[model samples]
Target: MIIDYGATPPIEELSIGDGSHLANYRRVYASSEKAAARGEVDLDQWFRDCDAAGIGKTVIKARDVETTFGGRISNEEVAEVVARHPDRFIGFAGVDPNKGMTALRELEHAVTELGLKGLNVQCFENRLAPDDRRMYPLYAKCIELDIPVNIHVGINFSLKSSPEFGRPETLDRVLCDFPELRVCASPPGWPWVQELLAVAWRHPNLWIGLVAIRPRLMTVDHSGYGPLLQYGRTILKDRMIAGTAWPMQPMGRVIEEIRALPVDADIADLWLGGNAQRFLGM
Candidate 1:
C-alpha cells in the first residue's frame, strides 16, 4: 500500500508538451522532468515498475502549469488511468493557485468530480505565497477531504523562469494556521532537506518524501541515504514517506540507490515503500 504523493506533468504548449519535458533529453524544463522522460518513467511504466518492486500504489498528480509545468500530461489523462485501475492508483488533481478562485474550484472538481484524493500545488509558481490566507479556503477543502496536500519542497525550480514563489518553509505558515492540513513534501532543491525535516518533525501532520534513486546518482559517497535514514530516525521518521517521484525519475533507480545503501533491512524497507504505506493510511 505504498503511496507516492508526487507525480505527473501536463503535456501542453511546448512541442515537448510538459514544461519540463525536453526533446531527446536535450533540456527538459525541469530536472525531474528530464529524468522522468529521458529516464523513461511515465505513469504506465512507473506503475509497472512499482508493482514489480512491491510498491502497491502511488498517488498520481496532473499538471496545471499556469505558473510552472505547462501540463505535460493533462488531468484527464491521469483521470482515465486511475479510473482504469481503481485499485492500483490514487489521483491528485493539479492546479495553478495563481488562478485564484478558479484554481480553487478546479481543485474541488478534481477531488469531488474526478474522484481524485489530493492536490499537487505548485505554490512556488503561483505568484501567490503559500502562507497567504488566500489559499486557506483550498486548504480547508483538503482538510475536509482528509487527503494530504503534497507541496514542492527543498527544490529550487524555475518554471520557464516564471517566478518560483514556493518554498518548504512557507508550508510552516499553512500548518501553523490550519492544524488539520496534512501535507506531503516533494523534493527538487534537496539542498533544503534540513528545513523540510525540521518542519515535518515539528508538525506531525506535515510529511516529506525521502526522494530516492536518481539523486543517489549524484552523491559522491553513495551513502547520502545513510544521513537521511539517521536523520529520519532522529526527527521526522514518522512524517516521512518514500516518494519515487515518477514521471521525473525512474522508480527502479530509486530502489537501486536504496539497495546500494548500508541500511539494515528494516530501516531500508521504510525508504522503499513502507513509510509511504503508513502515510497514505494503506
Candidate 2:
C-alpha cells in the first residue's frame, strides 16, 4: 500500500490566495498550469491520477499560518475529507506555534475530536526555526498524542521569508530534545542533503521524506541527493518515505520514477510504501 506523505488536495480551503508571501512560490514551484488557470484543483482528476498511479493512500495536510501570513487550511476541512474517504486519505493537523496554548488545544482537538492522524508544520512559512522555543511545546504534545510530525526541512521558495529558517541542521537540537517524537523532515533537505542524512542517521526516530522533489534527480551524479540512494539502500533503508507533494509534480510521474530508482526490490518496496506503513503505523 503506497502512502503519499505530503499532498495538497483540491480542497477549496487549500487554495492559495493573491498574497505577497507566496509570490515566488506561485511563479516557481506551482506547476499545475490547468489548476492555476482555473484558480482551483480538479479533485476528481487528482483522485483518478492517484488511482492510476497505484497510490493507495494520500496524506492531506492543513496549514495554519494565520499568525504570520494569514493563511489557513482548517483541520475540520481535512477531517471532512478523511471522514468521507478513510481508506484513501489520511489527515494531518496544522497548528501555528505562535498561537501558544491555543495551538496545543487545537492539536488535541484535531486528533482526539476531529480524528486527524498527524501534524504538519512549515517553519519558513511560520517564520520560525525548527528549534525555536515556541515549537518545543508542540513537539512535546506530539509525543503525548503519539502522532508523527512532518516538518518542512529544505528550502522554501516563498520570498517573504528566509530559507535559513529551514536549514536541516536546526533539526539536530529538536531531535536531541524530543528523541521519541516521530519526525519526518521533508523535500529531501536539498543543498544540505548530506547534513540531513547525518542527522537522520543519528536519530532513529527521524524519517526523510522525498516529497516535492523529483525521484529521478536522486539518481543523477553530483546531484547531492545521491547519498539518499546510497544510504537509503543501506542504513537509512527503513526510514525513507515517499510523497508527491501533488500540484508541485504529477503523482503518476513521481511514483513511476520512484519505482524506477536503482535499488533492490525489497528496498524499493520500503521507499514506495513499506516504510510509510511502518511510519504511519498502518
Candidate 3:
C-alpha cells in the first residue's frame, strides 16, 4: 500500500512557459529525446514506471492559477483520469481562491459531483499566503466537506512570486481558525522545518508531505532537517508521508533514498506509505 501523496495527472501535451508549473520538468525530460521531441507525457509508460518503483497509488492534483500562471487544468480532467484508473489514482481539486464564492462552489462540485478526494492550494502560484483571507472560504468548505486540504508549504523557487508566501508560520493561523481542518503541508515546509514540526506537533490533524525533497538529505547533519528526521522517527512518526513530486525526482529513487535514511524500520514504513494511506482515508 505504498501511496504517493503528491503527483500531477498524466498529460498528453505540456508546453514550456515562464508561468508554467511544468516548466521545471524540462530538466527531467532532457535525457529522453522522445519526451523532448513530443513535449508530452506517455501516460501508460508513467504508470509502468510507477509500477517499477513499487508505487501502488498516487494522488493526482491540478493547479488553478490562470491569472498568474496563464492557464488552468480542470478538476474534470483529473477526475476523468481517476475514473479510468480508480484503483491506482485519487484526485484532488484545485480552485482559485481569488474567485471567491465561485471557487467555493467549484470545490463543492468537484468533491460531490466529480468525486475528487481533496483540495490543493498552491499559495505561491496564487500570490497569496497560507493565512490569506481569500483562502479561508475554501478551508471552510473543505471542513464542511470533510476532505483534506493539501497546501504548498515551503519556499518556492519560482521568481514569479514572493518566497515569503510559503512561510510555515502562516499555517498556524489557518490551523487556529479551522481547528478541525485536515491539512497536509507539502514539501515538508523546508527551511522552516522546525516551525512546521512544532505546528504539526500541536495540531493532530495536520500532516507533512516530503514532496520534491531528497529524503536522504534529512540525515545530513546540517541539512536543517536533522531534528525533523529524529522527531519523525520518534513522536511524530505518524505525521509524515512520502511524496516524490514526480518528474522532479524519480519514484524509485525517492523511495530508495528514504529507505537509506538513518531511521527505524517502523518509521520508514509510516513515512513511505502508511501515513499517506491513513491521511487519504484508505
lDDT of 1 by residue, 179-254 (tens): 8887777663255555666677678887767653353543455433334555665565556566675555766666
Question: How many clashing residue pairs, candidate 3?
Answer: 0
Q: On residues 95-125, what C-alpha lDDT tens digit does candidate 2 reach at each position?
A: 9999999999999999999999899998998
Rank list by lDDT: 2, 3, 1
lDDT of 3 by residue, 135-215 (tens): 999998998998999999887777567779988889899999999898999988878999999999888999999887778
Error of model 2, residue 18, in angstroms: 3.7
Error of 3 at 118 (Å): 0.2
> Which segments of model 2 are wrong by more than 4 Å?
30-41
Model 2 pairs in collision: none
Which pairs of residues collide in candidate 3? none
- Candidates' lDDT values, in order? 0.62, 0.87, 0.82
Question: C-alpha displacement of 155 in model 2, angstroms?
Answer: 1.0
- Stretches of candidate 3 off by over 4 Å are 13-41
Highest lDDT: give the candidate number.
2
